[model samples]
Target chain A: MSFKDSYDIIVVGGGPAGCMAAYAAAKENVSVLLLEKDRDIGSPVRCAEAVGKDGLEKILEDNINPRWIAATIKKFQFVAPDGTVIFPQVPMTGYVLHRKLFDFDLGLLAANSGAKIVTKAYVNYLIFENDRISGVHVRINGVQHIIKSNIIIGADGVESRVGRWAGIDTTVHMKDMETCAQMTLANLPLDDDTCVFYFSQKRFPGGYGWVFPKGNKTANVGLGISGDRARSDSASARLESFVHDHFPDASILNKTVGGVPCANRLPKISSEGILLVGDAALQANPISGGGIATGMTAGKIAGNIAASAIKSDNISADFLKRYEKEWDTACGNAQKRYYRLKEGIRKLSDEQLNKTAHVLKDIPQKKQTLVKIFQTALIKQPGLLVDIMKTLNPFS
Target chain B: MILLHDNKCDFCGTCVGVCPENCIDLGEAELNIDHQICTMCYKCVWICPVEALFAEKVK
Candidate 1:
């Protein structure tokens, strides 16, 4: 396909957030162009490929295809630093996804909605008109082009350049960034319907390890350490030791490394003519570092807002504040609560974790709900009691 | 000075995100660092998962 001189809206990055934004905007009959830096929509999977079943269903509705799911998770276990396991009986369902396929499918949806998709199109910088964000300077196939747009959506992942270009403070502190490494391993025997998390300050300082099953004796084994704590050893080295100690006979299939922003959302996510979604806006859960569902949510909101802003021809930062207000009401508020809880959880020592596990072990498995577990874990930090209640409040 | 080992670098952009200077550009297949702009804070070097980045003294 050839290039266009201008578009009604330009969506950067082809991840879930980007595609969803394109899909929503295009569905509104606006001219949308989606740009992806990678050669493919989802070739290099950066995430652990897990999402809540309800969240996925809410976005895709009846279009939830089985092809994108690798494993259906029904339960999860938490391993304390002392090796004590506590399985909370929370009523939730999740899926280990084929992110490559899932992301590609979302892209297809956007294309079907009349959005133009372009891969390997690197956006070098943003174009400003009269000191207001106007468009972008993109380079594709060694040739550069300036594409003007009424609005720009920055759906780029953790390494978001668009936000920085627009003068938003997208910098993550060393203590808030999670330096991660993961390997897909085969022949590793694990429960197909269960996910496992290991917490150990000694092993994974300021972070944790996880084993997410992909099915049939295969899993994604990985861990993330806070940037401040990763100075002593690389994340790859830590994962290597973890894999060796846990699944000695498993064969490594693939290796991936990246960073996850575990901090709260940016103070500003929208400028005059640009809106930031996904990791660009730091929408990932602070405690769990999950962004797929939240990214999609942000994308849908941004896309819809972009369409309205274009139709009304009022693309000022003041008009775009609607996106920020709506986002905070929808998911950003919950993320703020999660960030508070994460801060509380980070202060727990290994001994405290072990003690919490021991205390939870005595309760009947059926009565060990997630709320109960958290209440016991944060018993010492009375201040966090209100945060726990607010974080887990279903009504709010 | 900051040095990046091509053999070890995966272009995953982990270092790009934490660079306070925002001087690193992650291309499709290669990672580039603008040394003139880099302050040698070593934040990227420390956060690199693969140990692909290094800090060296100028000879």
Candidate 2:
């Protein structure tokens, strides 16, 4: 069969957002193409692989695929420096995932919906015609292939080049970027149904550390320190030392280091015949740096919008703005609030965290919530009053 | 050029891991250094486990 040089929609990237976008676009029976630069769809994984059960339930179906899940969590613990642990008694569903399987399955779902999948395709630029995106110029198998498309979706992630090529401001401010380093550890016994968070200014200023258990004996231990404060310091080294000190007997099996965009949201997400989803649009959860569910949500919305626009023959920026509106209404407001909370949390010091932990320890575990955690953090730095008020306001 | 001595290497693999251009390659036994696509972020130098690999800042 001759390779078609055009598609109804070309979705760049095959991550959570890209996969969902392609799946939605193809489900409409439109000829779609999903491109992934990685040899394997989800190899060389990132993210801490923790997602709330309620959040997953809304997005995925019952009889959830076990291949994607490493374990199910039941408890949450946040420890401050000096090893003061505050057990927040909120019941939530958490999952440690096998990201490679999860991402690959999502891509396959898109393909099953009729989206053509291609790997090792590097998209270099967007093709423009008369102030509209016509398609993308990609190099696959060392040969440049130009695939024309009516609508383009950017699911390219933090290291995205598509948003820039499409003329969308994709720069991540150093202060807003979380420098992260993670390791899969063995021989560390942990609560199989509990995830632990450690906050220490010296170790992770402007960010925090996490231990998401894969089983009773294995876990993904990692930390994300705010890039701004770490300008002269090494966040990754600090993380490694902390891990060494905390888990002296554990062996590091694999390591992944990357940056997460902590920005609230891109002011604009769509342009003429083009749209951005997931990390490409900075849709990551502000405090946690988790975006699989959020990105997939945006992808589904973008696909629907693209299909509607194609049917109406109106794929202009103004027409595509509906995606921005719908996505914001669905999840943007919460992300914006979380961004503010993240700033507050980033500014906290080890002393402050310890103090907050001390206070939370006194409070009944059953009474603890994220709001109380923020309130306690703000107790020392009352200058963040406005933020506290905004946080207290449930309307946000 | 990038060279990470096994004895001195911390095995952090930060050299290969942080390379934006995917220049450095990590192997089980030794670090694979690629000079072709090195953007020279020097992030690896800061992250090396045993201070084995260092980058000469380009002038």
Candidate 3:
């Protein structure tokens, strides 16, 4: 088979969002191509690699193959700056993943569904004809090629040039951006079945640090500092200091540094013949910065819509807004409230975090329900109560 | 032509994508901007997150 000069849809990026978009769009037997800039599907791991099992299962149809799972967590531990630990026994599960393998598997599924997947194809710009997006010019293997497509899906990650080139205003505010550093460490004594989150404005101003165990003696330890606080000291330095102080004897296996956009969903996700999905559209959770499930959810919606529009021969802006409405109803509506709660919680001082833990320690063990715990922790921000409720219990 | 900041360059390669001339090549070892082929689009200067790329004198 030879490379085609044109396709029905072109997806730029090979991460989860891009793969899912290609998989969903190609399900209808339309000619689709997925372009990945990197030679490998997933080499440089970014996120903490921990995701809620229930949310992931709901999106993946409860068929998570064990091959991608690094570890399964049964409980969550919250640590305040004063050494107070609060274990929340919510009936939820967490999964620490081997991201390199998971990303490769997603790409394979996209190829199996009839989407042509290519690596090292770096998209340079969008082609315009009659003031509308026609296709993309990409660089693959030191050669430049202009690949035509009826529609373009910009599933490229944060700091996405696809959306910017299309004039979609994809800029993220510094306050809502998170600069993170993570290291996979070995020989550390950790609870493999627990996800521990540490809060201290002193160490991780405007954000937090986490340790998610991947195996019996190995773990992913990382911290994120809000962009506003990261101006002086890079996130790398902060993580290095935290790791040395907390896990002095731990040996580092791998290290990664990146940023996560923790802002509200873009006011506009679709324009003309282009649709931005996942981090490109700022679909990450505001407080948690978790985006895998959200990216898949949006990718599935955009892909199904794009293919349907191609069938009807109307890939117009008005028709594509159907995806916007559906996604807003599915996840964006809840995320609006999540953004507010994140801002309120991010401003909490280290003194307040310690005080809240002290108060919680004195409370009787029987009264420590998830709802009660959140209620007390957020008592000062009464204005955010209802939104927090919707955030904590999306089902309700 | 595009001048690079050796210290501020994090190898993000935002410039490679934004360059209209496609004169910039980001390899594993170095990010090179071929001055002979560059059209001086200056998009790379505006696109760099760290302000690592700049135009010393408009070509």
Assess each model's interface with DockQ, reporting 2 decimals per model: 0.83, 0.11, 0.13
Per-model chain A TM? 0.98, 0.95, 0.97
**Candidate 2 deviant stretches above 4 angstroms:** A61-63, A380-396, B1-59
TM-score winner between candidates 1 and 3: 1
Off by over 4 Å in 1: A393-396
A217: Cα error in model 2, Å: 1.4
Q: How many angstroms is residue A172 displaced in model 3 relative to the true structure, after the best TM-score fit? A: 0.6
Residue A240 in candidate 1, Cα distance off native in Å: 0.1
Model 3 per-residue lDDT at A124: 78
Ranked candidates (TM-score, high to low)? 1, 3, 2
Q: After superposition, how far is residue A347 of candidate 1 from its true place, in Å?
A: 1.1
* B1-59: candidate 3 lDDT, tens digit per residue: 57998877666544553354546666433578899998886555644545566788863
Q: What lDDT score is found at residue A353 in candidate 3? A: 85
Model with the higher lDDT, candidate 2 or 3: 3
Give the interface-residue alpha carbon RMSD of model 1.
Answer: 0.8
**Top candidate (TM-score):** 1
* Residue-wise C-alpha lDDT for candidate 3, range A269-327, written one tens digit per residue: 99888999998899988888888888888998999899998899999999999999999
lDDT of 2 by residue, A1-396 (tens): 135899989999888899989998888878899888766788768678887666666766563688788888888888888899898765467788888899889888998999999987877788988877899988787789899997999998776667767877766665677777788999997888888988888778777889999875889999887655664556557767888889999998888766677778888789988899998888888878888778988999999889888878898789999999999987898788778777777777777788888888998888877668777887766765566555542211
What is model 2's DockQ versus the real complex? 0.11
